[model samples]
Target: MDIVLAPLATDITCAPSTAVGQGGALIEARSDREAITRWLIEYRHSPATFRHYRKEAERFVLWLEFRGLSLDALRRHHLDEFEQFLTNPLPSSHWTGPTRPRHHPRWRPFRSGLAPASRRQSLVILQGLCGWLKEAGWVTHNPFALMRDRRRRLDNAAPPVIERYFEREWWCAMWKLLDPPVEDAPQRSRFLIARRRFLFGFAYLMAPRIAEISRARMNDFRLEEGQWWWHVVGKGNKVARLPVPDDMMTLLREWRAELGLSDMPPPHDDSPVLRALDRRRGVTDNQLYRVFKDGFSMLSDALIARNWSQDHPLIEQLRRATPHWLRHTSLTHQAQSGIELRYLAMNARHARLETTARYLHAENDEWQRQQARHRLSRIE
Candidate 1:
């Protein structure tokens, strides 16, 4: 059987079949693909969550098609095999390709093999899908429930240390590159320089996720009781009003002025904070991601031009840095500056102190110093 690999959960509004599955199903979805589409609709309000769940579900469905099986036909042993497959998807030609539009003929299910964390996340999502399907009577039982070590395999209780952030020295260097003197900056590129300055300044100070930055509007920044605050709709559709510091407000003012807006945007102004080259329309999340990616690449080139080794820690970090690193850098720097854990959690919008605590590296610094005491004495 030659299975042509293609995306499966692309259409959220895909009509469920009138026919029902075995075991008195509640949902009208007869096929695995339709059932997965129904499940994906549950996350429609959360775009990020919808995209994530769809990717995992689509991959699983493609894998099932390759195995000549259906979702309800999944077994514990099959899941174990799928888990292994995620690490090294076989016949890479069919399973992997560079990112492309879903409708593109060359589009594949994966960019490459999943790492351990990514594999765990994929399994967790599929586990939830099976649980939901069981409740909807699409399946007789959740195959995930059959696994003896399900909890141990899926739980991510131990928080990994946050390492993907710019250290102080590197951050300072980046700022210098981002904010060259007005005289030195070319007139044609002033708008771009100002935008980059404000963009990264906003990221470091507010620690907003890329989507938040993309969706931000001028009126999101407002004055209240002699202070400015940025109103945002963040992860899980939660609304938050974060303080706008003096530095960030200055950057906002500069960016707004460059766009020919008032120093402080009026309450009724819903213009996008991050504008396109036209200075009118908003940029998408992918565009925002590219801005950071290209900025880091440019910074890496600048460092190399300055005779910095490619292997230098800062250059290497820049090579791997993504937009999310700004958020990590913001929170980690705040933790290092002795901000109370409670306040740090509030700033990060994290529900648990344990999650925020991962940013704390003071103990690590002290431990390193303590270990230094055990070094062998110098020869006379």
Candidate 2:
């Protein structure tokens, strides 16, 4: 197993100052390995962040080793070379497709070329690491300081290459497939899939991020003056109250009844809204994502098997869908409905109203495209 691919944060058996046998532990430079290990250990409070930082750090370290370079020996030019490598990994290297499991023989740090945003993020992490090393007196200077400024100006930028959500037809298909035994299945299995339907439906209606949805407690929802609202702690720890659409509220009531609970949640109930498999605890973000992906994959496969054209755009989108797409789909659909921008922003818990405004721009662009398509077609 590649040392870089070793379980991050949990494997402390590797020596602090050297490679761990044939596993090829990262931070290979003897002078800086111990310090890097200590820095990683500090992230125990946030395992996900630790894992992400470790992967980027490990990639840089291994790249250094591949080029017979060390952290202390790096210069501005060397950093440029590393940036280039991130954009296009060596074809002959062990890296596999991004989806390959960690244990795969061909697995490499990068599965594909990093997009502009990803490349920038990777560089930013390295810059922060260099700054930390400089502050700790391990390195004489931060090499990142020598790198050119690459700050992103989000304003006036064109939309991303891919719109990360489904169209109405595909979206409705996804929703419909959530119910009924489309094919023969056991009662117990069907019941659990019903729970998954509610999860996805709730996600679509609320437009909540995965973290917010995962952390939701039954008590977080309330019926104030007969209007349903969900209190969520969204990104940046900002607390916001979001209105629950009537249809979503009805779904919630049905789901609660299925769980043998009252249709209306109690004011102070601490029970998780999204329960674990045992129904004894809250679901983690990873688990929530799995539920969504499983549901999506099943829907996609069914659509493909239904004699839908293989090259249809809807099918293509479903094939690449992730949990985040649900949030995007909700917001995009809301925008298309001509909801007030300020209200949409509030519902999304966006810190910057500009973030919410992008949806408006995307909608306008799409409308214009349709008009152009019609105009371009000469009359029969």
lDDT of 2 by residue, 1-380 (tens): 23344322334444344443244334423445455665676576554566678888777777776677767788988977887888887753454354444556655777577767677778877777877766655566677776555344122234343367787677887787788433467756755776788888887899988887888899899889978889988765668988888888888887787677887899978899887666657888767877887877788788888887878887777777788888888888898788988898887777667778766656567788888767455688
Q: List the pairs of residues colliding in candidate 1.
A: none
Kindly give the stretch of ten consecutive residues in candidate 2 with the minimal lDDT sum.
153-162
How does each model score on TM-score?
0.89, 0.75
lDDT of 1 by residue, 1-380 (tens): 34586676555554445534465777767578888888888898988788879899989988888888977678889988999889988888888997778878888888889977679889888889999988887877888888898777776565567888999778988888887338566755887778788888889998998988999999999899999998999887888888888998888878887888889999999989998888899999878888898889988999899999999999988987889999999999989889999989988988778889889999899999999899788899
- Residue 34 miss distance in model 1 (angstroms): 1.3
> In candidate 1, where is summed lDDT lowest over 10 consecutive residues?
12-21
Q: Which residue runs of candidate 1 sit more than 4 Å off their true CA positions?
A: 1-3, 9-23, 146-149, 180-188, 369-380
Which portions of model 2 show Cα errors greater than 4 Å?
Answer: 1-4, 7-55, 65-68, 87-94, 97-113, 128-162, 180-185, 362-380
